[model samples]
Target: MSHDAIVLCRLDELVEGQALGFDPLGTGKDSVFALRHGGEVRVYRNSCPHLEVRLEYRKDRFLSVDGSQIICYAHGARFLPDSGLCVYGPCLGQSLSALRWHAEADWLVLEAGQLEACAP
Candidate 1:
């Protein structure tokens, strides 16, 4: 079977210690986000575990002030960038949904079917 190819962004476009969100499905809201931490790229669903709300306060604003943690502005929950662990806040002991992806040349990508399986 074949699936539509989806490219989130270019590897070089990802600044270390920052998160970039994408709406690959055109859901009008970002469905997932990716960030570079410790020289590796990690991706996770954009929703917070506490209330299923988008994790950013504004576009590409998923990190805390220091860029050390992912912050869900809705409830002030903080998460570890590498593991999506809700280290502090209402969702403590829980984690954001993670997505597995692979990079192709300069693009960070996923197949349409892969994202569809991860969608709600």
Candidate 2:
């Protein structure tokens, strides 16, 4: 991993179509999650655009039953996995704030500076 990046998880640890949440700064609420879909990884802030609530209904439960979209159980918002675009619920046309990350040898690392800029 790069010296300046915050390692989130190993690339091999993420299962396809699943989301994993993390608190890179050790903050309890301003968390982010990563989804691996169709063999690619996408990351987003956990907050729901409509209400500023966490997207998962339960721990790491961010994807819809079919694993085709990211679902915010707070109000039933659904977002496109690849783009974080909300396609359903109150936040339609809005998007989840994406976090910048890159794959290293066997890990996923969040851009260190970007994490600070995203602080609430």
Clashing pairs in 2: none
RMSD of 1: 2.0
Model 1 misplaced stretches (Cα beyond 4 Å):
1-4, 117-120
Clashes per candidate (backbone, < 3 Å): 0, 0
Clashing pairs in 1: none
> What are the per-residue Cα lDDT tens digits for candidate 2 across 1-120?
566799998988888978888888887754888888999999898889997888888788999988899998979999999999999999999999998888878889888887774556
Model 1 Cα lDDT, one tens digit per residue, 1-120: 235778899998889888898998887878899999999999898889997988898999999878899999999999999999999999998999888777888888866666874465
Ten contiguous residues minimizing lDDT sum, candidate 2 = 111-120
lDDT, each prediction: 0.87, 0.86
